[model samples]
Target: MSTETVNPVTGKIDEQALVTKANRQDLRFAIIGFVVLVVVMATLFALVLDFMIDGVPRISGEFLTNYPSRRPEQAGILSAWVGTTLVMSATAMLAIPIGVAAGVYLEEYAPKNWLTDIIEINVTNLAGVPSIIYGLLALGLFVQIFRLGQTILVAGMTLALLILPIIIVATREALRSIPLETREAAFGLGADKWQAVWMYLLPAGRPGILTGVIVGMSRAIGETAPIITIGALTFIAFLPPAPLQDTFPFVNFDWLNSPYTVMPIQMFNWISRPQAGFHVAAAATGVILLSMTLLMNGLAIYIRYRIRRSSR
Candidate 1:
């Protein structure tokens, strides 16, 4: 038990004694929080280590380069990885500019009205919506109405929809973190709202924005349900057409309309097979998927660090 003391000289509560008691409480809480963090980290590390142990030996050049096959020994992730790369590229190209622009408009330009409030609330709520829901929606809209088919474009659009809310929220939060004084100073210098946001606020908040983009993409990469729901093939042996051509107007858009499968879908297909070798292949795919996610996050962190260092 702890006791509070009164200062005999001033007939007041002892500030130093109160501070000591508060510090003790804070220290106890801190220790508890640290213990919880360690437990979570250790658990995650163990799971990842198990995957690595099962999968690392199976990873090889041929495993990466060959297409999926009925024979587990011959099966590889070439088409899946290539499709994933193309889809992610399309998703990033579509989502970033649109999400960022919507965020900036909502934060800096939108009036504080009921309609804006509803939109904001909806955007926030959409972030928690299941990926499968987006898939169903995309199937109805993009696939049926737009006749996009179960192609890379439709897949990218679906994932883009899934991650848009995340990027918007991140962008708004990043912009909001800029100091009021900074905004005032920009205004005082005769800079317009657009100039202030484009020049100062964006550069200042880029690290946070990039972090959010990385997080959203990481989530998108391992998503299987949506991709499956959108009719991604379980066993695709063919690659998308090359984006570059030898003829005039060399950049081709044919690949966007090509049937595709992502890493998660490929892994799912492998896991569903009864063969133990396929299970091993699934574990290896998980390892590769995890590695790709980590590499993306690492690259984002490096870029953020560089941005901060340059700004300083």
Candidate 2:
């Protein structure tokens, strides 16, 4: 099926000209896309290289275990890392179930009416709202109104709010990706909506849902503004009380009430210092942060892969 036709006036087919014109357009777009990709990769490579060169040698066992100090040589990220883990753990626990449930309700159970439409629109809009705004809101509501203070709990709750819309959107998308026939088949088998969703649609869509969770968590983990607005200390010197102390019950909710700091805040504090040693330490902290983020993403990918395989 040739697209070309003879130019009757020239008494010859213009097939070669047409093909060349089409190929030229395709090649132009391809080259542009490739150049953009190369530029992005190059930029990322340069940043990673800088971190390695200026950061890696500074990383050591002492850096991992010791607390922050006024002296650059003595400062470590012990409290920062601990706070990050605790806050992220709390954030995930609070956000995932609530966010996913909201998404499922909106996507699967809610009527296609004006109220649902408005709610959906707001959720979508919130996803794009500046992170700083979430910080401000958390400062007012979580820190002041709730009287949570500058604890890991407050920071976690604030971050949970910040990433909630993202998780909801992601869950809705994942639910939507499930085939309509699957639902229909479940109904035909005498299953209720809840059963269909729980037994069939949820498992089918778990991978996409997990992907969204990972993205939301990643965003939450890296955020500084919200935590800072809630007055998260930048120079925390001690770990929050352990979740499992030697108390009778063997569990401590009091850890949530303690002061906290995170990797990003710590890195920011270091980078702002006048000392070159602090600068190097900042880069090393960046390396650790980057590594943790990558590890989280990789684990999510592996989990997604496993879920997909199991479903098959």
TM-score of each: 0.85, 0.87
Q: How badly does each model clash, as a count of residue pairs?
A: 0, 0
lDDT for 115 (candidate 2): 96
Model 1 off-target regions past 4 Å? 1-38, 298-312
lDDT of 2 at 59: 98
lDDT of each: 0.90, 0.88
| Clash pairs (backbone) in predicted model 1 | none
Error of 1 at 200 (Å): 2.7
Residue 304, candidate 2: alpha-carbon lDDT? 67
Q: Residues 102-160, candidate 2, lDDT per residue (tens digit)?
A: 99999999998999989989998998999999899988888779887888888888899
On lDDT, the candidate that comes out on top is 1
lDDT of predicted model 2: 0.88
Model 1 over residues 1-312: C-alpha lDDT tens digits? 233557778878887888888899899999999999999999989988988998899999999999999999889999999999999988998989989898998988999999999989999899889999999999899988998899999999999999999889889988887778888989999999999999888888888788889988988898888888889997899999999999989999999999988899999999999999999999999999999888877887787678667657
